[model samples]
Target chain A: MITSISLPKVEKKNDPSLAKFIFRSIRDAWDYRWAIETFVTNNLCRRYRRSALGFYWGLLGPLMTMITLSVVFSMIFHIDIKSFTVYIFTGLLPWSLISDSAIEGSQCFVSAESYLKKLFIPKLFFPFVIVGTYTVNFLFSLTSLLLIGMVLGFQWKLSLLLLPAVIAVTATLILGMTILLGVATVYFRDLSHILGVTLPGFFYTIPIIYPAESIPEQFRQWFLLNPFYYVIDLYRQVIFKGQSPPIQDWAVSIALACCLLLAGLVVLKRNEQDMIYRM
Target chain B: MSAEIQIDDATVRFRIYRNPSPALKEMAINLFTRRSSGEVLEYYALKNLSLTIHGGERVGIIGLNGAGKTTLLKMIVGIYPAFRGHVHVGGRVTPLIEVGTGFDLEMSGRQNIYLNGTLLAHSRQEMMEREKQIIEFSGLGEHIDTPIKYYSSGMLGRLAFSIATMIEPEILLVDEIFSTGDALFVDKAAERMLSLFDRSQIVVLVSHNMNHIEEFCNRVIVLHHGEIVNDGPPAEMIDFYHTHIAGRGSNASTEDRSPMNTDFSVASPSTAVSVQEQSRFSMTSSLSE
Candidate 1:
């Protein structure tokens, strides 16, 4: 004789689990704010401690690169100087900001493995500090860009009001990418290698040197799909064209930034514990 | 405040993946056959171990290497998670897992004091209040301004110990970090440990040194291969440990002795004397003794 076996059914609850998780992440970050601030300040001071140039080095690298690039592209390629210098500077500023943030953010946790293993501080701050420092570096370059624009006889206009909005968009986009790449770098270290190769290619593809109109009609839609294009286009519109970004472009970029931010937060929350083992 | 640190059936398990390296051909084959042995390895670092530690109790944890002593301490301090059971730590935990683990070698000692103190959860104002006391205890005087990389291991250990012990945490979790300094520093450290016990109710010390275990801890827990074999007063536990070691030594010698001499009397006297000496030394070394 055989008896039928019955397993107990588990009850499923309908709840906003993600909201709870995000709330916990925010709480954890709040608890570890002191540790994060100390870590960042210490790291920043340590990097410049032995340097002869001190923080002047921050301004030096971008200025040298810009001068070299402007000479080669403007003089040799016979590029138009009327708005091209400001255009290139604007694009380069944000691109470098993103690239520097991405590279440093990806290595943050891996380098802090010793601290992470011994303490239970929030891991999000590693990427936050990396991006925060690079943003400071980017701000220095932005000042130089403004100075160069004035030197090139470009008129400053009210479209500069759109500058804050553009910065918000750039920060949002970088924050999302930083968090995502920071967590992913712990797992697939190969992602860092892939990013190193792809980032430069990405810059060239985004029309930092040329206008979007230069793209063939057949390829225009394909070009618009690249997120960096929208970011760089907004920079050119404000600084060179003296016009604010279109409502449609602003809406699309904001939505994309929000999506990436939320997605990155989700990934970071899920992998918070696993990060210890991976790193 | 109650000084008891209670752990009830706490278990910590880790899941690790074991993936076979798949060549291009293997990947293609697996796409169809799906016969690869992709498995997960589950390891229990600490099994269902429970302990109750009361105020003024210095408990020592003894085990062979990799017997989960460090894991247990880390869990108590909430550095690692427990897979099952409850841990109720009554007060602030200061874990001195390693001397100078968090010290930045490039930073000056004064700067590192702020950094280290902040990481240990002290506010700037709080650390500032204790600044004079910490420096005095460290005994580094003029060297406090120098980069920590210039400091010797003993100097680093002293700085770390002074900073850590200065916080006056309710519960202190110490690993085998006290062996870094010279005899003078060791005496200073011992004095500091005794002072910490005046304020800290529970002190969990993990060390391989039997003398340290017997001296500092009133009660001892014997762990072997991830399980607690005995938990009792230090005297009985030390005796059990010595007898167990002696039995293993005698058994090993009996197997390889001369062909004609099958008697086990040769391994008895010396083993007995060594065991007695060890126990006597442990008793005298005990803080209560």
Candidate 2:
């Protein structure tokens, strides 16, 4: 007689528990640091497995680029070589780091679609791996640049102590941009193609090959608007000019990097679950 | 006492995007055309469903293709979020969703063992200690030093299965994973899974193979249209599954009702009764089996 006809209704809450959930996810991501490192290492080593040189190929690209740049701008252009090699090398070092990181970051999630779909691991680590692997390549190029600088008789400046601070700021800026572009590239596949064309043009505008002073006085302030200008200028000040970067430049660069990083984190957190749908 | 694993009214929905006519003119016209401003179409992959899996319980999920069985397993593993409810898993969950998921094809198997083990939450030192055992279980011998790209699909599956089950996770989630390898490896893998079940508190397996479900799981749940149509002992649930398939005009004929034999050397005793039932339903083999 007591045949159950009705089932109990489950109550639904209007408010979503988004904040606590995101916080917990970030904490979980931070706890998986070892897995992130292994992923990066595996990706880097996987690219050149069939090559006889293995990882030595990491040095090939930057070395060739540095040699080509030094030859064209210094030799053909008849630019002064007194301290120009050191200056150009310094600028190229950070430029390659930012450019390679950006290029790799833009393609990061798109390339790892299989792994991303299959695993619940943190997505933020994908871009980190891109930047981290390129950082290793950048350091390899940096070592060669330092040797060239030394051979060309450039003296070590006391301001070189600020090198670590400069590197930290550059890394922070690159990290922020990488995260933004990486996530955006997932939705707009054309973003990578746009980056491919824009990077070379943008490189000339940055004072990598030429100093900011080379631009006319009327355009000096406009050149400062480029973030890479400040980045290249920081390296120039420490390695070439033998003086510390002004406090304002450091403050502004750090602020810009942190702002970009915060914005990227917000976008990533909001889109994390929906990312699979987009992919 | 520890809390048991509970799936509280979980639902999963998928949005299927349909492209407009492929003609350029049609695509351009559709781009300019607007109908409902905010309407979007979606398909329910898994409807609201609840199940309580207690400690020391082995439950098998069986369903036809696209029945949301894999979606349920992914939800339990935390890879997919439920649209409506929460999956409160009580302990560490190892999802054997796909073989070689995290393996680096360019990395040597020996190196990948450490990498894959770390992703499974094992420390470097822990992987180091278990390195020999993992290699031996994989049976790759000296070939373990070669990059995984050279491995056949079976070898890769064996290696992945070995590394995954090596860890003592509290819960194991397997999704048709045993059907990957050769007969010998399958037997070995099944034995490993059985041993793991003895130690783990909960095991949830999703497979369309009724024999596997009946052999490994005490309880089986049959899903249809993302809803649980049957939930009970494996024998009854499997019968319901076969009936549902037969009703759908499946080609499971009485002549096709071969005995459930893993090795095919001897017929399983249960298969004899199943074959007898199939003969009675042969006319409706297109209806009821």
Candidate 3:
């Protein structure tokens, strides 16, 4: 008979498997869910504390942006004021989630420097917090979009029930990109500035204000190759156009989201332990 | 039943780089050049350190600044991974390595307790349950609801200390925390720490103060240049670190060496110098023998 009398241990291994690394990091993200929720709550509370309107600001802020963009672009770009406003808000809100996550999420490790030096909080927790904050903001902007769309006589569709699916796909894609960019940002601090400069150019790549039909027939397929274009297109189909997205659009979005999510997790898993020293 | 620490030839190396962060221009150039550009200086913060502290032992780590005392503590707590060798720590570790972090300054002291507690792997319910204890121990009273930024540095220290010691951990890793807080609070903190010392299976204290180490620790380890120099009873180990490792440039024979430079400066000026010399002579003679 074998009798074992040993205690628990924390051992350092020269070689760590990426599968285990990712699994553990992901587990910690759930394990510390309270911290992430608390951070996001504190952040939103602080942001709205000074403003008199409080939670309405979450709604009216996007409405104001939509009104501003619709007026300027309607005349300049020769688009209809009503449909155009609805269209811009739909694309802009989702894109902001992506762009903001890419920009701020990159600094997840750098910004959390104060905390990282103190405890053993998982590296993924901050990235999740960043995602969580943006996700909440996205929901607010979405509510604002729906309210404004109804007032502007934009039609609602049976596909509206599927909005959660679109948001999930978009969020998964954004989260994956943000984690990858955030990890890379720790190694390359300059990536943050690069994101700032290129994000505007990336915005135009999606057909938010411009009509999708405007692209030349020869170049249309290549234009569709932009994976984010598919996500925005899906949003446009469901909310802006009041129709279900094409099955092909759903396939592209889900496939890209899955690929990006796996790659991001794999990258983070491989480099998570080594990151503490770099900071 | 108790925490055990085993570090076998553990080594940690840190790389210092000139312009370590890859600039946009450097990356753009490197894309075509096929070469790396940053100048890196690699050095070991810990070198082949083999140590085993059994359960129920209070170990004091005494060393001069830059002797890798903090690095060793971090390695044991699983912050910095060992570049070479193995480190196995049994049971939960609570590291007070660097305080005044893991908190949002804009958040109130009450909120910070939950934030920091969650960072220590405690659930929200656990923090909520301990909130009263943390507030009582911190002695912040009515000020607990105020933003942490409004609290004085000492008040923040109390809050940090209270949150860290809210529950008894199996292994408590402290780094010179006794230096903070006022006289009354330090005594209170010391009393709290001693109680923790009673409950913890292993307590590792890294302090520059010789008196605290001598009074509290059953065993002491002397560190010099990222390696363990000596390990034994607290009095002798502190004595070893104070004499041989403290004054690095001067030989033990140099009579003019300042005794005030080391922590063993409580004696009279003449006696301090002679005591240091005698301690130095005994260190060398013991090695020779």
Name the best candidate (by lDDT).
3
Docking quality level of the chain pair in candidate 3: acceptable
Residues B1-289, candidate 1: write the lDDT tens digits: 7667888898765444343223446557866886553343445667888888888888988754445777788788776666677788887778876445567777788987888787776777888998889899889999999988788767877888788778666788887665546798788888887777667778898875678788888999987545688999888887786666323544324322322111111111123344334323322232121
Pick the DockQ winner: 3
- Mind giving the per-residue lDDT tens digits that candidate 3 earns over A1-279? 111222212234666676777677789788889888888877677778767898778778887887777789888979777888887777877888889988998898887754564467777788888888898889988987788778877777787899999989988898888889988988889888989999989888887767789988998888887878889888888987788877988999999998988898888766666677667
* Stretches of model 1 off by over 4 angstroms after superposition: A1-16, A80-82, A158-169, A242-248, B1-8, B14-41, B52-57, B84-90, B124-131, B244-289
- State the number of backbone clashes in model 3: 0
Q: What are the per-model DockQ values?
A: 0.24, 0.22, 0.29
Of the pair 1 and 2, which is ahead by TM-score? 2
lDDT of 1 by residue, A134-167 (tens): 7666777877777766776778778988887888
Model 2: how many Å of interface RMSD? Answer: 11.9
Query: lDDT values of the candidates?
Result: 0.70, 0.71, 0.77
lDDT of 3 by residue, B1-289 (tens): 7679999998886655445577888878977997655545455678899999989899999765556787788898777878789999999888876654556667788988987788777889999899998899889999998987787767877888888888877898988777456898889988998898888888999887778899889999998767898999998887777678765544433422423223221121123345435433433332332
Arrange candidates, best DockQ first: 3, 1, 2
lDDT of 1: 0.70
Model 2 docking category: incorrect
Q: In model 3 chain B, which range of ten residues has the least summed lDDT?
A: B260-269
TM-score of each: 0.80, 0.84, 0.86
- Give the DockQ (C-alpha) for candidate 2: 0.22
